[model samples]
Each structure stands twice: as structure tokens, then as C-alpha cells.
Target: SCLTDTRMMIKLRAANEPLFTGRRNAAKAAWRAILKELGLQGKISTYQMAKKWDNLKRRYKDLKYPPVGMESVADGASSWPWFQLMNEAMEGRLASSAPLLTPVTQDDDHAPDRTPKHRPRPAPPPPPPSDYGPEPFGGGDAAEPSDGPLGDLERQWDALERDRAALDRDRAALDRDRAAVDRDRAALDRDRAALQAERLWLERERAALERDRALVEQDQVALGRDREVLLKMRSFPVSFSVSIYRPVSEREPFAGCRPGGKPEPARNKAEFFIFLNFILEAEY
Candidate 1:
């Protein structure tokens, strides 16, 4: 659509330029002839005619007349002729109804360029005013030393310090409790070691006692065998014999003589022998 509008504007510009030139020249020539007929040759010259033509052309070109209607242009160069014919037809129809148009004059040096101008940014809003009200220190009227509230804050701080001290004492107590537990655990370990050692000693003593008992049992068995042998030996007994010898002197025999007594036999070399045997028996 923009392309179409641009092409139409180009055609309109081309057609209008030539039309304006021709009409303006014709008007200038007619004015010159009228001046000549009035016998005022000094008033209008060829230069004056050209200047008037230029002014008329500018006036007509600035007129904002709408195009009669849409016209389709197949060829680019043919658009000018077609646009001229259409514009003449539209102008004839609105010759008496349309208002006269004036051109806008522009100064080449002072006129703003086609580019848009950048407006300066407005200054930031001023900062809000400070609120000066009654502060914790004192009112804004005068500086006054605080007596009650300051003392209350100091008391609160002191209370906090006391609480912190109490927490420290509790922590110390817990540390002592932990140390006592550790000591108890060490003592328990020592006691276990002693008990283990005692158990080992008891086991060794039990083994020694078993060995001694075994030896005693062996001794008892040997003593019983000896007793049995002795009993068998004493079951029987046997025994034996005796022998005697004597010598006497003759004088002794004479002294002991009596009338009816038998005289002792004269001492003489003599020998006698006797043998006896005995046996003893025992019950089973």
C-alpha cells in the first residue's frame, strides 16, 4: 500500500508540474497583452511575466486538492499523462466549489529538518522533605538528656549480661559432669581388667588341683596293692629247734652226800641235744 501511495504521489507531482507551468505561462502572456492594450509597456516586462508565473505556479502547487479517483497504471512513464487528464477532469467539476489554497513558505536556513527533534528530559522530582518528629533521644524543639528510658535500656543490658553469665556457669557444670563420666568409664575398664586377670588365675589353680587329685588317686591304688600282698604273707607260719651242753666237777658232789641221799654225779664232760617244731595257721 505504501509503495502504491508513493508511486501515485510521484505521478501526481510530475503531471502537476507541467500543467502548472503551461497554465502559469498562459496567464502571464494574457496579462502582458492586456497591459499592452492599456498602453502600460513600462509596467510589465518579460522579467515581470516570469516572476508572476513563478508565483502562480507556487500557489497552485501548494493547493491540497484530492485526486479525482483511483487510476490503474500498467506502465511507469504513462502514469504522468493519465494523472494529468484525471486532475483536469476533477478540477473542472469542482471549479466553483473548491476553496482557494495558499502555499506555505519555508526558510531554508531556519526551517526544522525532516528528522524529529529530541525534547530535553524534565528534571527529576525534588526529594521529599525530611520528617522531623519526636525521636527516641528527645523532641526536635530542644536537646534534652534522657533519664528514665536510658536507665531502662541499661537495666535490660545488665539483665542480659547476667543471663549470659548464668549460661556460662551451666556450661561449666556440664563440662564437669562429662569429666566425671569419663573417669567412671576408665575405672570400669580397670575393674574389668582386674576381674579378667583373677579369672585366669582361678582357671590355672583349678587345673593344678585336678593334677594333684590324679596323683593322689594313683598313690592310693599302689597302697591298696601292698596291703593285699601283706595279708597273703601272714596267712601261714612255721618254727623250730633247741640244743644244750654241760660240765661238772667231783668235789662238789662229795659235799652234798648223805646216808640215804643219792650222791651227785661226778662232774664230767657231757653234751645233750633236743629238737622241736611248731606250725601256725590263719583263716582266710
Candidate 2:
């Protein structure tokens, strides 16, 4: 996304335009048309388009590839000479058509603005042979002169180049850090997904356990009724197993309790009920 957008902005700025509002509006209209082509007309609005463009412009405006031109950046508090150059270039172009910068009357005027005087350029030196190439190191005019404004400008440019190199290194380090952060975020996301799956499994197991508990409660109810009927019947066999009709010693009817731990003989239905509940706890 960044590559494609930077390329597009490079093309638009090749003319050295500051990309004012009218141009941005035109670009926004073009975007709407593109959305229409993509069958996304309903997802378009002027404010949204303008906002996207504004954000892109603010972010990419600082993206100077080699950081050669425009030495100063105006951070909203003060004016810079580079901004004056841009304004001069713009006004120079607009001088022919637009009448916005008109002369003010004496009554309306506060003070005359001091425009910087531009110096005329010197004539170019004769070109060398095409095959000769650039001047060699420490040879001819390739060396930095020790005086004059030109020398100062050269020193500034070299300093800016060094600054740009440092910025590039910082940006590369930030990219590596961002990649590591993304990897950690992806791993965290995987762990979160795994936790969600495990929680779901636990929920299913709890539901199965609840169904088993319901079945056990139902069995207890049925077993109580069966015991009541047996107690009411004098023909009840003393040798019967509590779980099933397996044979046991004629006296050991309490599902083979501990030796000599035979429950006292029940005298009534209430005692029989107590015995039945005690045996039921053993899953009899």
C-alpha cells in the first residue's frame, strides 16, 4: 500500500506542486469514480474521501527520498525560507490568471511586505566530453572551497545528507522492531484461540456431567419406590442383591456390608427407607 501510494504522489508532485485543496477535490472525485467502478458507490462520501486524502498528505509530505531540497520544515509555529520559495513559485504561476493578491489602498494597508531579493544566476561553464565522466576526488572543482556563501550551502547539504542517512538507519531499526511486535501479536492471538477452544471443551464436559447427575437422581427416585414396595411385601427375599437379583447369604441382604456390620433388622417402613438410602450412597 505504501509503495503504490508513494509512487502516485511522486507522479503528482513531479511538477513540485503543494497539492492544494482544488487538486485534492479533483482527486477525491476520481476516487469516487473508482469506487463506482468497483461497485462500491454506496460506501462513498465527500467528507470520508477528503479525510483520507488529508491523512495521506500529512503522513507522506515528510517522505523526502534523499532529503536534499527544502532544508527547513515549518512546524506550525514559525516561518521557514523553504516555504517562501514554494509560495513564490506558486504566486509566480498564479500571477497571470488569479486576482487574489491585489494592491491594497492606503487606508486599508498596514505595512508593505518585504519580499526577498532573488539573485541572478551565473552563466554555465562549457560541458566536458561525455566519456570523461564526473571530476575525480580531490581533483579540479570537485573539492569544497574554504569560503563564500556557495561553500556554506555545500556544507549544509553535506550535513543534511548525513542527517538523512541517520534517519534511514533509524527507520530500518523501527521496521525490524515492528516485525517482531507483529510476530508476538500473532502468537498471542493463537494462544487466545486455543484458550477459547479449551474453554468450550470444558463447557461440553460440564454439560455431560450434569446429564449423568440427572440420570443418577432419577435412579434414586425409582429405587426408593421399589424399596417401599418390597418392604410392604412380606414375601421379600432376604438374600436378594440391592443392585440386581444376584444370590447372597440368606442373612446378608445389605449388599455385603463390612464383616459383622450387618444392619439391624428393619422393624418398619421408616427403618427400611433409612437402609435403602444408606445403600444407595454406595451406588447399590
Candidate 3:
């Protein structure tokens, strides 16, 4: 089936969208979506879509601006099916310094009679936008291989993606380290609390020991006083006194004390006086 004017316009408009000029993958995806929307996915591959867009732009540029010697070349572009649609889509996109018409000099007018006028080939379209890189339109003219700005942008995008992946890995590692640090801090706090409790208990035990020591000191002092009193008592002399009653007759004093109250023998008087002197000396 032939593509209608409406379908050609749709293709031109879709190709000119910003999404079709982004990163390679995104641009290809956008082109696939455009093809799917046009119900041409099975018939037209993504590569075909890209090539079609490139060819359209090249044709539009050729028709819009004829080459140096082909001033009247664009005269037939109006009859082309997609020319108007491409012109509309590519409005203000193509930039050129070449004059649309070449000035005729009197010497060149006279020299033109020597040969038939030849139509020069149209030049390639202007470079794409700086932000966008060249799209890889496979099967395009080999002269217009996918290179230049598009290749540089693709490489830069790839580098940026690699850097982003590295940063993500670093961020994940940092999060894990932070979690471990928090756990370690919690453990240290628990240890500190336990040590504080143990210190308090030890202090209480020390206080109790101090009290016991004080009581022991007081008991020692009291014991020391009691010991001093006992020492003094021991150092003092102990004496016992006995009295001997001298009767009218000293020889008969013990005789009256006898159980029968009988008179003592005169020979026992000397021994009795000696016993009395021994008791007196012992008392002194």
C-alpha cells in the first residue's frame, strides 16, 4: 500500500520531535513508537525509520536550497508528495550562507553558449543541533556515515552513565557503613551503662566496708581502755591482814581457842610465838 499524504506528514512531524534526537537508545525507542503508531512496525524496522527520516531531511534540504549551479533545481519540489510536510517540520532548522540565486555576469552569459547547462548535485543538509548527536541510520548513504557530533555525544553519555553507576555503588556502601557504625555506637552505650551500674554498686560496697571499719576501730579503743584497767590492777600489790589477839597470858591464848578449852603445854608456847611472827612478816 502507498503511504498517504497524512502518513507522510505524521512521519515528518514525529521525526522532528525532540525525543527522536536524544540519546541513541531513546531516539531508537521513539522511532519504534512512531512506527508502531503508524501501524508499520512489522513492515518498517527502527533502522528503516531512522533512515527514512534522514533521507527526508536530505531531500528537503536539497529542494529548499539548490546547489551552487542548480538554482532552478527547487522549482519541482512543490510537486513532491512530502516536500511541503518536510518544509513545515524543518522550519527554521536548516541554516545556510549560500545565495539561493547565482548572479549572472555579462562574461558568464556569453560563455554559457559553449556547452549545455549542467545541473549540479545537491549538497548534504546542514549539521544537526549541537545538543543532539548523529543518529546511527544504518543503510544510509555511506558518504553520510553516523559520525561527527552524534558520535561524541554518545560517548559522553556512556561515560556519564558509568559514573552514575559508580556513585550509586559508593552510596550503597556508605549506607551500610553508617548502619554498622550506629550499631557499634549502641553497643558502646550499653557497655557504658553497665559500667556505670557496676561502679555504683562498688561504691555502695566501699561505703559499707568503711562503716564496718569504723565500728571495729571503736571496739578496739574500748578494748584498749579495758586492758589498761586490767594492767593497772595487775601491777598493784594485793595484801591480806590477819590479827593475833594477845591474851593476859600469851602462852594460854591458843589453849582457850582449842575445842575443849584445855590449857596448852608450856613447851608449845615458843612454836606458837614463831607462827605468829611468820604471819606478821608475811603481811608486811
| Predicted candidate 1 versus true structure: per-residue lDDT over 129-203, tens digit per residue | 322111111112112212233435434433543465467569779999999999999999999999999999999
lDDT of 2: 0.42
Write down the lDDT of every candidate, Cα atoms only: 0.39, 0.42, 0.53
Cα miss at 203, model 1 (Å)?
Answer: 1.5
Q: How many angstroms is residue 79 displaced in model 1 relative to the true structure, after the best TM-score fit?
A: 82
Please write out the lDDT profile of model 3 over residues 1-284, one tens digit for every residue.
34452444244344435453334355445554554455553444444445556566676678788899887878768666667656755553322211122211111111112233797688899666322222332334323323334445544544553465467569779999999999999999999999999999999999999999999999998888777766654554332112223343533445345456544555356556865575454444
* Distance from true location, Cα of 53 in model 1, Å: 97
Residue 218 lDDT, candidate 2, scale 0-100: 100
- By summed lDDT, which 10 consecutive residues of candidate 1 come out lowest? 132-141
lDDT against true structure, model 3: 0.53
Q: For residues 44-131, could you state the per-residue lDDT of candidate 2 as single tens digits?
A: 3323323333333333344222145643432421222123322333234423222122211122211122233776587798777322
Q: For each candidate, give its TM-score against the true structure.
A: 0.31, 0.33, 0.37
RMSD score of candidate 3 (Å): 24.3
lDDT of 1 at 166: 69
Between candidates 2 and 3, name the one with more favorable lDDT: 3
Measured on C-alpha atoms, candidate 1 has an lDDT of 0.39
